[model samples]
Target chain A: MDKEYQIQGTRMKFWMPKEVDHHKAAALRDQLDRLIEMHQIRELILDFSETEFMDSSGIGVIIGRTKTIGFYGGKVEAVNLSAQVKKICCASGLHRLINIREVAENDG
Target chain B: MTDKKTNHMHLYFDARSVNEGFARMVVSAFLTEMNPTLEELSDVKTAVSEAVTNAIVHGYSTEAQQVELICDRNEDELTVTVSDRGVGIADIPAAMQPFYTTKPEQERTGMGFAFMEAFMDEVRVESVPGEGTRVTMKKCIGRENGR
Candidate 1:
């Protein structure tokens, strides 16, 4: 809902909601790209604790963001992946480029 | 409610939560019905996340479009259909290649499909230029049919 995202050094956080469908991908990417441009972040830590679902379009976001971080010589880290989310991430071999973990939930 | 409609769920969301973390949650929930082993579930979740992310960033450019996720379960078999009406892929075969991507400036590994194939039993993709793309993936628990 917010256009601008806050970033500390290179780490940035964002949340994906349950209403995002085909129509919301553009705006989401715009926000993410804006955040990326503004922060020039090195390592992006994505917080996906609340998301309910994702599709092929969602995959594009990861690929696009990973590319963004890779351009900055940084990397993306996936955090708190649920089984559904992890299935796709693991299948895509995303771990080879980015690190994914369940640390946030462990702390909670 | 337990007759024939208990094994179906429809989810819709934006790219905001498709982050690597949220992707995890989505996958976890998807596997709950199957009661799969951790390793088996993990593999499925990762594959699903991969496809969803593609729809967000590449499919819709992760702007603000809606993502539709349909899950159907039959016994030990689960089928996930992730669809998006965003910028469709211009090249199907090229996109499926191991390391080919249009967003070179973005530093994409270009292996989204590769990973999907490695994790899920079957992956099917259908796209219409200027329309959208839909990816269908299926896997069965405890069968070890095909990966």
Candidate 2:
């Protein structure tokens, strides 16, 4: 499986795809979980710079991963969210579950 | 005042997860003539995606089936309906409730109906216990500021 994530020490930053519907969310879920386990990820950062669309399935992917890593007090942060994605994150009550950063600090 | 043209389309495809994006694209493409705003297009696409995903994930549930998508535009109002002849819902009210999902293991957030209702002007669901489910949603374009 092609890795869609980057790992540095205990942190993993995942690059979200352009469209995050059920089909893509499923694949992302599996890959993200596997990467989290393999790398023992503690801090997960979802980079939404490329995401233009997202539905409830994408919300499920985020919540599922949050629960997985939350068991060990791991944190999940989302960055560079677009207007459409921000609305979804708030509407699904995901804004409270994870930290959403409007701009990436390092600009990588 | 020139009369606005009315248009309609019917789409039938396999109830597979892969077609979810195709359904959204078709609906957006169909609405291009209306000159929808960016937010308007995004809202419709999101709602359509939710409805189609529900049919494939909940209605069919691993069984290969057919999903039907119909869209009609009369004036500025757009109507979209997605239907499936697979296993239907036992209680639509319970199903529409936020955070109520039968496939928790699959990580379903159960917010499908909610998103449709939120983004669209109106949403209606019809289902027969053992028959199937049809979701119809309506939205009025170019009226965001007026509303």
Candidate 3:
């Protein structure tokens, strides 16, 4: 399964499917770290286009990455949020922490 | 978020839906409208998942249980409730604190409540130890025009 991540330029993008609770959280974290290291990522834009949900562990992944990205003077952005998923991001204060732009944000 | 507000259909779910993200999206899609922003849907979905996950893992540790979801929509409010009859939390304040987790090895972020608090207009978590837990969240949809 190519659930790892894809890197290009300074943008380290990954797919976060919901159900990212404890069991898979560790794996997700490791995967993110490796990608950041591989491309020496300075900026990240996660595509949740395929993801349906997330949990505390998933939140941890983002927060931890925010810290990591901050150290490198990078930023994290999220695009393509379903209404329901957007609620969770707002509830988690992800909007404040990360740059949340819908697919249209990448447009004009 | 800058356009207008609209009401969403009331929703429900089971424990299985929360642990599995796709199951949750089934409900998320149910609420999407022509103008429904992705951020709006994501926030609600996350809060629902967090609540339901709490029901399954914390509320029903090993035994069979059910998670009940009810969504209510009015002119300006969208409320979601996730309830389960599992082991209840002994301390609410501590659990609400950032980074406080009952299971650390499980990689618990302990930010579930934090997220809910940030996303919803009102977030209340009530638990009766050995009984169950219920999370009620309310948000004002399409607050663009104060609708």
Q: Which has the greatest DockQ?
A: 2
Q: Which window of ten consecutive residues has the lowest lDDT sum in model 3 chain B?
A: B10-19
Q: Local distance difference test, per candidate?
A: 0.70, 0.92, 0.71
Pairs with backbone N, CA or C atoms under 3 Å apart (clashes), candidate 2:
none
DockQ of every candidate structure: 0.15, 0.90, 0.35
Q: Please tell me which predicted candidate would have the highest lDDT against the true structure.
A: 2
Local error of candidate 1 at residue B1 (angstroms):
18
Looking at candidate 1, what is the lDDT of residue A64? 80
Which segments of candidate 3 are over 4 A away from where they belong? A1-55, A62-108, B1-14, B17-23, B33-35
| lDDT, model 3 | 0.71
Judged by TM-score, which candidate is best?
2
lDDT of 3 by residue, A36-83 (tens): 987899888777787765666676788788889989899988888766
Q: What value does the lDDT take at residue B53 in candidate 1?
A: 69
Candidate 1, which segments miss by more than 4 Å at Cα?
A1-108, B1-6, B17-20, B144-147
Model 1's alpha-carbon lDDT is 0.70
Question: lDDT per residue, candidate 1, A1-108, as tens digits?
Answer: 642334667777666654333335567778888888887778677776776554444556777878878987987777766666665565556667688887633232
CA RMSD of all predictions: 7.9, 1.8, 6.9
Rank ordering of all candidates by TM-score, starting from the highest:
2, 3, 1
DockQ score for model 3: 0.35
